[model samples]
Target: MRPSSTGAPQRQGVGRRRSLGVWLRGGAPGVWLSGGAVAIAVLMTLGLIGILAVRGLAHFWPAEVVQARYTPPGLEARLVLGQVVEQETIPAERLRSAGIALPPDSGETLTRELFKLGNRDLYGSDFVWLVGDWLQDRQTPADALVLERREWGNFYGYALEVREEGRQVAKGAAAVPELQRRLLRTRDLSERLERLEKQDIGGVNHALERLRLEGRGLELDGRLDATAQADLAARRAELEARYGELEDQLASLRQERRRDSVVLRDVEGRTLELNLARIVRAYQPNAMGLGAKLGFYGSKLWEFLSADPREANTEGGVFPAIFGTVMMTLLMAVIVTPFGVIAAIYLREYARQGPLTRTIRIAVNNLAGVPAIVYGVFGLGFFVYVLGGSLDQLFFRASLPTPTFGTPGLLWASLTLAILAVPVVIVATEEGLARIPRSIREGSLALGATQAETLWKVVLPLASPALMTGLILAVARAAGEVAPLMLVGVVKLAPSLPLDGNYPYLHLDQKIMHLGFHIYDVGFQSPNVEAARPLVYATALLLVLVIAGLNLSAVFLRNRLREKYRLLEE
Candidate 1:
């Protein structure tokens, strides 16, 4: 028999309600929310990275130089030439408040362009803001030059002539090639001079210092024999003779560097002489084709990676900071891994379950939440003062008052970060150890393997991936930590790298630059904010890349270990 229409409708409604109830009960809504949240987070991260890449990477591209005449209210019209760095629209009232008079017909909001007028020495500023309406006769001159310099920031002008020893060797159309050729020569001389000063002479100085320290140590030990003294004197004489030769070569290079100079005429028709040695690279940005610009960009990027800083660190590369960050993170990993794993093994396999053990685990967990700066203070007081001072008093007594080990340095920084990261390692390792089934341990014991042997051979091999996971996390945290390193060993600019060709190749007692601190210094502490802003973005991007690279390496190792030990786990 056919069902009634109302009854059939009621049955259909019942069926729909049942399906909805089942969907809710099955957790489909929660799953959707979780997936959506993860997607949003991934998108946000990608967006942030994209912004950094766009802003930072653009700084290396050569921008066309523009020449224009700007007429400010109540001021004489003047010629201006520079790269247009930025533009913004602001309330006209704000400009008027800052002494800029706007015309009656001007809108409530006005647009202004930030010109990177370089020529810091001539203009007393690297950048200036000019209202869009006031800028007239704008043109991109192909002959306009942008001179990257070692000091006084960038110089923007038109190349006039190349002078060698006060005589005009090349001028007009031929001047750019002559200047480029002379710059190449100066670059070679500069490299040679740097090698002589930093390596050859530096080695001699280091040896002389070692000799002095040895003699002092011998004197303290009551073993300063005449033969030892004679040996020390001969070594000192040889070092001093080598130093004298380096000095002579350095002086000759300096004289040769001063021989060739480039004469440039500013937009204001004023002539200026710049030594070829001072110029890093001179390029006509407006004249460059796409291929030339790309090549220049590559070179600029390479320079940012390899060159030493100049201009109060607002310019140049961050190689030292990069080295220090990686070295410290690696050292921290080395020191923390053994301690963390040992502690975890003892807690999980050896320690009796009791109130004391529980309390210790709680403390370790709490330590992971502590402020990083507190670790810095503790490290400064204990590692730098108490323990380091004692070491200096004992092993380095001859260097007393100088305090070789009793100082904030690479060792202290690494130790501080190790302590900061240990809690993470401990927790991860403990979790990994607890995950292994009891049958695995019991089988190993039944096979006549000792507990220690079981743990070392069977358990550890399976847990290697977890160990690497902890290490990856620790490295990520330590590499980007700036607060602790600021107090421990990080400096604004390190004159020398901690690792070099010198004896005791790894100088743990020396101060080092860190990329995290470099970003902070460049972003906040730089005198030229406008000039340094791009560098800050570039450096921040570099630091993120470095941390990502380190983590990827660890992740790769972890994956390899997991694959190798998959069968054992199964």
Candidate 2:
């Protein structure tokens, strides 16, 4: 009886082991592991994007300005006016170690608030931390004014009076409306000033520079005849006359802009006279209703998207960076697609299946894994120094010492990114070509088409989807590349876009701003850490969106091509 019972238990254990082995062999565990990994990766990505969005998008929202009397231990009570930017709890002991006093009744931890005291010219800092407990008589005054400035960061105070040419135009309750009305005038004048400076004067300067270069070219070519010299002088005189006229217009516009000023009294009761031209926008946040705040937010957001960056790139828009990134990526796609497709076609269709071909294929695959900085170095050496120098010597000799194409610029940046992205394209294209059935080629040949005809009309059309797929991959990789662009062409601030109203408008030999590099510059290299922090987040989010937008465009084209060729594949 005992032996039979032991045998039954042993049999049950054997049955359990068999079931476990079967489950393992079915691959359920591997499937679950892969799914879990993918889920974790997706969750992490979403969390990061959420953080970026929250931190970035909130910067444009106008928060009510707080007025309070703060009394710190051993310090006199003073009025503080600014926005409460952040709040945190710190240990009481830590505060004491930092030479801050806490009351004896204070518990283990004490809360503090960070204020954006934006009268930087007065306080010498944009931010200050004060103990929440020490703040008394906190209020959001409806008359508190926040001035968004082009320089010296932001100014927070109350409106005192509006002035025109040192005369008080309006005061007391009437000043705000008068200031707003005059601000409109200043904006119009400022726009005119900018147009005269950048367009009229800039065009004259461009023409003058071209004339100078032309004369240099004529001299270099030994063609500086009396007629040519006289013609050049006449054109120069004409451009100078135009420039003088534009400068007069610019001076008049500036005088009009500087005509109006506003008197603002800060919390310290000291008054400041700010020119209307310096203030980009002004509003009392506490006085703004929800609808007005929303409208203001939308305008600020639009400005961030379309305006040029100001205040060391901690304020204003990233339009130049956006334009440059898209331009370079498109140029890279245009340059890389044909080269990658041709190489792929050769490797798959023309090359003999030998050891040399295999070795070349292996090398091409390995190039994709190479560090991007290595490509930058190679581009700087070969593309910029070698090829570009040759081009400059041959064609742009008049701009020799200045080095037009010989310098790091947009062309080299695009070319470098193309080289960096080509390997992926080649591999993707090769895979695509390999997938085409051999019978399709043979069938085309049987119908009297030549090899080239069959390849171009029959095979290549079928492979268009593959070409787009490769382009999508290339753009996805290249658009976010910063290290290579930094060495090739990207700059912290590009004064003008690569594309402008000038003849031969697309200036490939000009430096350009990139979204990736802007994020890097604003986040790491900026001197105002607190002010730049929000901009860093905003710019990072923008870059991601830009890359995603570019990828989606390529993806859409790829899908369309795939749909067009779906029947052929079947």
Candidate 3:
């Protein structure tokens, strides 16, 4: 070896080449490529979530209201009051082509500002675009108030005076405090009226409906005697009396609500008297300090989560949608788990394994690939029409024309998703069952246990983690599915939640709102695109958080089950 110096250099080069070839053969290059792909995917997901959070959360912050004197070409200068919501640059040539004049020294590009001019009642538009160069001496006024009204979008103006019963109660600085005080009183009155209308009066209405249905049912059964008719009449009379009392209270509240009003002067020197009862909340964004604005932001976020939808679901909170989504997902989980586990157990443990079993497994796998809408159609036909219609005829013949469970509703929706998700559970459970060591099952049977007992006590415990995995996957799927739900239950705005104080409080027969459907409705079906845009982002963000929370909980349960059964599996 010491005698061949020239060949030693060649051997060293050959050794480096061999090492490179071994690396490729060991699959290191493929592993590196796969890792790079996974990293890119993770980064994209994070970026999307970050964008959603920023856009959605910024909507709640109070923006400073500015007064701008804008002049258009060959037109008189006008005072504009609004919040600057967006800004962008455009080519001057594009503006010139659109018949918009540019200054002699204007650069190749021009800037434009989109102002949220939110007096929809007066202007018929909530937003306006102005050439930034034309806006002269923009000023933020301390007295500029933003009134979030219950109707006609938002109002931006200066507070002039507060009046009660056609008399001026306060003016200027004094008016704001008086206005806030009256607004609090009005809000309390509104909440009281809502409770009376939705809960007390609603309960009476429900009782009356049930009484009518009972009478009809008895009539259909040929069992409506004089005594039964008398009982129904008494119940109806009682409910009517309660309803009449609520009506009188509501009338009195309305009269009180009409007593207070506020005068607001726009930048154009026009005064409009707005009823204080119609305002949701009024705030002076330019006057607010950081602490006050933070509090306002928190309050707005809370209201968004807790309040009911208003303005055709473009405004107000989405509590009903959130409740419906969570309730439906949980119901689907409950319905699917047992049936899935039973089917998997039967197929794997009891059935003879052969070519027929192989064919059945292949069919089950194919079912997992079937379109979700197909499942929805099947659910509508089988669950809603066939089974529910039969039940209606047998037990609810009195409510003939008005179908209860026979129509699209929460129960049918849950069942549809359950069927769609069952294949995942069956496949996971079968894999888990197959993985258990044969020795363990034989040992349990040898220790004076029957085969069934051995399978239940020993085999299932070891397979619990896999079962949890399947359930978690099913939950993730069911929570986000929209198309199938559209056919079965989901609606845009459900005034009353399915789980109300009505009889059979878990009203599975009721149509329910869902977060997925809400996103669809707000994003595409909204009449006011600008007003609903930010809300769409906020709702979508909340939905992502909800899904993440559910998945995390399931993952935690799965980890716990794995830990508890680790030694048994070993």
TM for every model, in the order presented, reads: 0.98, 0.96, 0.97
Worst-scoring 10-residue span by lDDT in model 3: 1-10
What does candidate 1's lDDT look like per residue over 1-570, in tens digits? 987879988999999999999999999999999999999999998898888889998999999999999987778999999999999998999988988777788889888999999998898998999898889999999999999999999999989999999999999989998999989999998998898889988888888888899999999999999999999899889889888988888899899988999999999998999989889999998999999999999999999999888898988898888888889888999999999999999999899999999999999999999999999999999999999999999999889889988999999999999999999999889888888888998999999999889999999888888888888888887889999999989999996999889999899999999989998999999999998998888999999999999999999999999999998788
Estimate the overall C-alpha local distance difference test score of candidate 3.
0.90
Off by over 4 Å in 2: 1-23
Model 2 / residue 44 / CA error / Å: 1.6
Whole-model lDDT for model 2 versus the true structure? 0.92
Ranking by TM-score: 1, 3, 2
Q: Model 2 over residues 126-183: C-alpha lDDT tens digits? A: 8999899899999999999999999889999989999999999999989998988988
**How many angstroms is residue 107 displaced in model 1 relative to the true structure, after the best TM-score fit?**
1.5
Per-residue alpha-carbon lDDT of candidate 3 for residues 426-447, written as tens digits (9 for 90 to 100)? 9998898889999998899889
Query: Candidate 2, which ten residues in sequence have the lowest lDDT sum?
Result: 1-10
Tally clashing residue pairs in candidate 3.
0
lDDT agreement of model 1 with the native: 0.92
